[model samples]
Target: MRKILVLSVSAGAGHVRAAQALVAAATGLHDVEVVHCDVLDFVPAAFRKLYAELYLDLVGRHPHLWAYLYDKADRAPREAWFSRMRRAVERLNTRALHEEVARQGADAIVCTHFLPAELLARRIAHGEAVPPVWVQVTDYDVHRLWVQPGMRGYLVAGDETAFRLRELLPDTPRIAVTGIPVLPPFAQRHDRAACAAELGIDPQRTTVLVMTGGAGIGSGAAMVERLLAIDGDFQIVALAGRNEALLAAYHRLAAAQPQRLWPLGFTTTVERVMACADIAVTKPGGLSISECLAVGLPMVLIAPIPGQEERNASHLLEQGAALLALDATALEYRIRRLLADPALRAGLRQRCLAIRRPAAARQALDQVLDADAAR
Candidate 1:
């Protein structure tokens, strides 16, 4: 069996989710062994903790600063001194990563996050016989950090992103517009009436699913309150992922309105809940949006973090699959409009169906396996 290593980081759930999706796809193929590696495990515990926490802090508390830094890095030249320094530090810190790769005897390296790709690219540049690297960009937009020259192929979310990659890395090879990889469950077709019955949701009422990714970082309670206040015959399914306090709060809110509200904590049944939903109100994280698209659920995107999330929101809006809710007022207005107008909701759902790539994970797996076959 050919061993394939998928590298990911936990700065956010999207990267790791993408990696897992690829693993699921690859596992179903013949003569392949897939390994999932959390790249942070190779580094010191302190560095790993800091890396994850720092991202949360910046995105949650200091988003504008994060946006500024993201833009500055994007504008910096690939070979600039800062870029070189950043790559050098990553290469040094990921010595264990290289060792792990050799020990696993990986035939190819697939990276969902950019850090591993950068480290591997540097090793390849220095004449190391590193395995071919395939980068699966987990966001709808590509940051400069993801642009490395030695990559075997680049997998992106859509044609617009492919166009952006061509403009940014004119000489890069084999950019595939594979859409973002989502889990098999999300990719499967689901019956609305059956799913609603399974979840104990009302089939006649419009169901709106609200989420804030796995971390439960967004305004779930506020959004739920706004949605409930609207005068409509709709039900709210609020998922507070891993946020116990938020879950408890939602439970309290559901107590008063049990018929119309359902509160959920961290759940493995997200795909099922999504299947029962008429629409989703969520942050514009790549994985969340991809899963929503897979279900052909129209979206009401909440305030995305100013960098990658902003880019993701823009892409979805441009595709006519989602409407943006910039604030509490906007969220209420958008929800009311969708609830009031079945034609508009149907239009958005059709657009989502048109753009959905349920087989993205399988397609990405083919890209990896085909590269090995060519060699």
Candidate 2:
């Protein structure tokens, strides 16, 4: 059996989601022993928890501030202070990561986030590594941190990103644009109308699905309240993710407006929800963006985190697959505008269909394994 170690962190749900999808895809093809490794956990537990808390605080409570920091990080010279930040983090936990990798006897390593990628890079550089390493760029944009000479291959989410990577490392033959890895359910799920019927939504009416990232970390309450105030004909289904407090808040809000809002707690059926909905309103996390593309669901992006999410949102906007709302007020206006204009919505949906990369997971795994075989 081939032992595959998929490393991810919980800073944001997108990384873990993408890693899980890769595990699902790779296991389907071979006698694969898939393991989820949280590289951040190699550090002290308190430090790991602090990073998680800091991410949520920055994204949910101080988005504009986070955006400003993100801009600075983005604008920083490649391989400068930003790279130093990563190197510092790697230094703190590199020994633990090296021990874990050696202990697992990983035949191959797939990194769904930059932390693990950077960890493996440092370890390999220091002669503390084993196995062939593949870095999956979960975002549409490439961060220099994900680039490492020791990596056997880089699985990019799209062709545009592949172009960008080529500009950075022109001589590398290990780059492949295999699309963004998404759960197998997205590739296998079918029948939007039937899916809608199952959800008790009117199949004929335009249905909008709103989700915060995987953890349901967006302003669902305000958006739902405004949408209900405007219209009730089109159904609104909001997934609140794992935030029990937010779920309870939505349930309380839905109690008075039962006919319009279908507020769901954490669920594994987002693929079905995306299939049934006419469009999705969400933060532009990489996994969510790829899932939308797979099902041809256009997006109204709101409040993406700085750093990687900003890049993901920009990519979608540039491709005409999504509309970005800078704030809650702008979000309301954009959603209303799209809902009112059938032609505009149709155009966005068409663009989404054109850019959809449904075979990403299978293609990425195939290329990674092929490279290992060649070696």
**Best prediction by lDDT:** 1
What does candidate 1's lDDT look like per residue over 51-124, in tens digits?
88998899888888998989999999987898888776676677898899889888988899999898888788
Give the TM-scores of the predictions, in the order they appear: 0.96, 0.90
> What is the C-alpha lDDT profile of model 2 across 212-312, one tens digit per residue?
63222335686677777876468788888887877887788789987677888777888887877887888888888999988888898877777778899
Model 1: residues with Cα > 4 Å off, grouped in runs: 213-218
Q: What is the lDDT of candidate 2?
A: 0.80
Q: Candidate 1 — which pairs collide?
A: none
Where is model 2 more than 4 Å wrong at Cα? 68-86, 170-173, 213-218
The CA root-mean-square deviation of candidate 2, after full C-alpha superposition on the true structure, stands at: 2.8
